[model samples]
Target: MILVLDFGGQYNQLIARRVRENHVYCEVHPHTMSLDRIREMAPKGIILTGGPNSVYQADSASCSPELFRLGIPVLGICYGSQLMAYLLGGRVETAPTSEYGKTEVTLRSGRSKLFAGVDTKTICWMSHTDYIAAAPDGFQITADTPVCPVAAMENEAENLYAVQFHPEVMHTVQGKVMLKNFVYAICGCAGDWKMDSFVRRTICELREKIGNGRALCALSGGVDSSVAAVLLSKAIGSQLTCVFVDHGLLRKDEGDQVEAVFGPNGPYDVHFVRVNAKDRFYQKLAGVTDPEQKRKIIGEEFIRVFEEEAKKIGAVDYLVQGTIYPDVIESGLGKSAVIKSHHNVGGLPDYVDFKEIVEPLRLLFKDEVRTAGRELGIPDYLVNRQPFPGPGLGIRIIGEVTEEKVRIVQEADAIYREEVAKAGVEGLGQYFAALTNMRSVGVMGDGRTYDYAIALRAVMTSDFMTAESAQLPWEVLQKTTSRIVNEVRGVNRVLYDCTGKPPATIEFE
Candidate 1:
């Protein structure tokens, strides 16, 4: 197993994701983790993540020098590199020119295992102000760039490596190759980690934890929740009860579709209860315009609904949620900025009746959740369904959410999806239509009219962390626009979002 020490970097999870892609299990922990605990975990390798602070700062994050003497392979990145160099008798100071973005680097050591198959000259993503001025004693300068002297350094005999540029980000031309070399070639990991083993181990763990106890699952019927439900069922069949809340924020006809799959007549062998609380949610969300406020209200209402259901079930011991890695990271992680609050994660209320809240898929990414779903033999239609946020279409509609607004956005989204599917647009990661909360003047049937506008968004991404706006076919966009403006009333204009994930998120709100 590889251990990624998070020094409050934004891309900490990305590092773990890359390691898992190499078929090696990895976990991310804060840099404040005790050395004794690190030894207890016995990881095959240790990766120190980048951060925003300089090693010279009075309160900067740092690990013990003994970490290097532990004999385990260690790789430091960006700020991590400066910390390693500073703690181990090396010079670290502000550079004459701070390197940011993609920079050209040249390798000085051809036999370096970290750059085994990498090119002599390559481009890497560099984001740092302080640079390693000098390598520690006995450490070789493996790579360097024009502005940065010690871009990469290593002490082969001690199994310590450091890179001033970020290797986890894709901007690095050969970042994956470098990471693969560190995980496999240098660390000697067998790379036997797979979804099947995760499934077996998680089921056993759930069974052992929830034995003779009643657990209620807040199943949304999305891939994550569906997989969590099935895993719990396989572990303890009747001890699990799934309560699917149809809060009316889902896609058009999604409530009934979810019921058809998990209801009494469905293939699964667990208790299923469907709650139609459309009015309840709409009432709670009435007159709420701020996105975060709407999210927290919806999140608290969901728990309230679940708490009532659990009371009916009598003596429930635990509450299960399908919160995943992206949800947790985007909500906020160890000094990282919060992009938005996921209803299941940051938006949750302060108090709850259950002894504990269980998230079976908490550490898994979106694709990893799908892999576990496939391993459990869930239907292809359910397993491959596009991801839907817990707050559902509430976040899709920008401003105040009303029943009429919900209907307009839902119909527009349905039509947009149908057209995209009909056109067979492959490789589109996620696509949805949102209400813009803006009214425009237009002429329809030779009469002047003012109606709301609908914005269509489509992105292509492997990990949801960073995404590029998909350039949809002109004909497809034109047809979708024409259909939404005509078929969906109250929408006079249709605009395609060309912004990517950095400036804008996948969802509108």
Candidate 2:
């Protein structure tokens, strides 16, 4: 298994995912983890993940000296690379000119394993105040940019390697190629890991872990939970009860798709329970202005309803979730600052009693989950479905959330997705319907009135964590906007979101 030592950077999980995508098993542990424990794990190769802190900081984090002498293949990224060099007696100094954003780095040695099938000049994402001014004793400097001299290095002769820039981010044009070279050429790991093998292994492992014990799962109809449900049902049969809380915030015809794939056509037993409390949710959300408060209310209420229904089925021994790697990283498990917490994170308010939890996809990526879904014969509707926020349509609505508001948003959102599908754009990251607070003047059958403004958002992202605004063809955008404005009632105006995923998240909230 590949070991990814985390320095608390946002891209740590993405690095592990890339390794796994290459058909090799990998585990992520904090730099604070014990060296003895890591040695026991016996990782085939080690990858150092980037972090927020500079190595120059007085109290920044660094790895033990023993980590460098592990005698295994090692790869470092961004701050981790700088740390590797610093720990090994390489000179690191604050750059007179710092490099950030997209920049080109030319390879110094063309006959190396790291540059296999990659272009001589590659576009890489760079962000650092300090850089490696000199290399370690036996390291070869292989790449450089205008800002940083020691941009890349290797000591493959001794199974040690390091790079000053990130190879996991999309801005790096040959990022995947560089990683493929590491996992394949250096690590010599066979590219045999696939969706079928992962599902089969997970099912066997889950069955052994929960032999005859009942497992209860929360279904949100997203790809992650739906795939987890199928995997668990295959392992424990009818012992799994899936509770889907309908807070009236899902997309058009979404509930039906969930029932169709995980319910009837599944290979395992599935007890489907749908709780529709649109009226209660709307009433409770009235006059709420804060987005975080709205998300908390939705989460808290969902838990209340789920536990109540769970009582009818008697005590469950386990709570299974489709929690993926990105969710865990964004949760900031061992990081300094709190980013954001998913519903399943931090546990049940320290009051509600539940048994041990099961998260099958805890170690997998978004693409891996979809692959597993397809392996289990899950239909295209659920397998290729776009991601929706956990807060559901509540976060998408700018003003107070109500049943009528959900209906309007749902209709408008449905129209937007259907039009996109009609345009045959297969791999878009996220598409959402936002109910803006602004009102627009409209004439319905010669009668003048003011109505809600509905905005359509769709973005393309190689990774769901960060994204750029999707540039829908002018014709496609015009068609989507016109259809929403004309066909969807109560939606008088339609607008496209132009902002990317930094200052604004995929969801407005």
Candidate 3:
């Protein structure tokens, strides 16, 4: 496992993803962690992440120098590199001209261990106010950027490598390649962590834990839970019952898709239950405007439905869910101090009775989940499915989650998704459709002006923690706007979400 000492960059999670992409296991820990404790974790290597704080700041965060004694390969980035330089008796001074955004770096010595690759000139993502003017006694300077005299440094004696820029971010085109090279060349870790291997091991583990008892699973029709249901069915056939609850706020054909996956081609006995308690949900939520309250009511109602279905299944022993990693931040079900959860948080309620919970994909990220699905022979159409909120279209609607409101949001959302696919951005982070509480006035035809407004929100983000306004191609946006206004009635005007994820959230409550 590779250990990353977190100095609190928003992109720290990206650093972990980069390592995992190379088929190596990696974990992030607070920089306050001691070398002795880190050594106990037995990591293959150590990476110090960049931070908003500078090393020269008196109140700056610092870790013990004892890390060098472990004889592990160390890669320090940005602020991390500054700290290493400071500790090694090198000159770290605040630069008069701070390097931010894209910068060019030129390799100085090909013989340098850190610069063994062929590139003599490379573009890098640099954001640093402090510059390293000198290197410690045995350290050799490997490269220099347009601004910083010593952009990259290496100490072969200590097996330490440092870069003034972050290679974990996408802005650095060669960042991923550089990281892969480091994992293979420096640490001797083979990039062979295949999804097939993950499936086999997970299946074996699930079987061992679940010997001969029956299990109950909560299926939300999302990829995570659907994948979990399929995996559990494969592990213990006839011992699992899949339950899906309908609160009437679901998107168009969402329920049908759920039925298709769980009813047929399902490896085990799949039970499909639809509870239409939309009125009860809306009545309970009457005039209560808080977002958290809305989520709680939905969550509570969902649990009640699942419990009602589980009773029919005759006292199952386990509850399986498609609980993926991002669920932590999404659902806000629990506090994960590190890594914000997406809309997919905690799986069953505390009061409900079940022996033990089994989450087959709990350890896997979103990408890994889809990859594992394909490896298990699930169709790409189902496996590469777009992400949907577990609350269905309830939270996606602004005012009240009536059946009509749900239908409008679903249709608009589907249209938004269709055009986004047509836009063909290489790595679009997330997209969604939402309804507004207020209406706008407009003229439909020759005569009178009418009212109503629909919103289309989408953004590109490395991690859901922060996001940038997705500058979708104008032609695609215009086409999408035209369709929503023409095909979907009651929507006189269509507006795009230009604001990013700070002042605005992914979902407009």
Which candidate has the top score in lDDT?
A: 1
Residues 80-193, model 2: lDDT tens digits = 889988888898889889987788989999877987887878888887888999999999999999889988998878777778788987878899999989988888887776
lDDT of each: 0.92, 0.81, 0.75
- List where candidate 1 sits over 4 angstroms from the true fold: 95-100
TM-scores for all candidates: the values are: 0.95, 0.92, 0.81
> Could you tell me how far off, in angstroms, the CA of residue 199 lies in candidate 1 after the best superposition?
0.5
Q: Report the C-alpha lDDT of model 3 over 213-287, residue by residue, as the tens digit.
A: 888777877778878877887888788777777667777777776777676665436655555666777676677
Alpha-carbon shift of residue 442 in model 2 (angstroms): 7.3
The total of clashing pairs for model 2 equals: 0
lDDT of 1 by residue, 35-88 (tens): 999999999999999988889999988888999888899999998899889999
Which candidate, 1 or 2, would have the higher lDDT against the true structure? 1
**Per-prediction backbone clash count:** 0, 0, 10
What is the Å distance of residue 467 in model 1 from its true position? 1.6
Worst 10 residues of 1 by lDDT: 500-509
Cand. 2 TM to true fold: 0.92
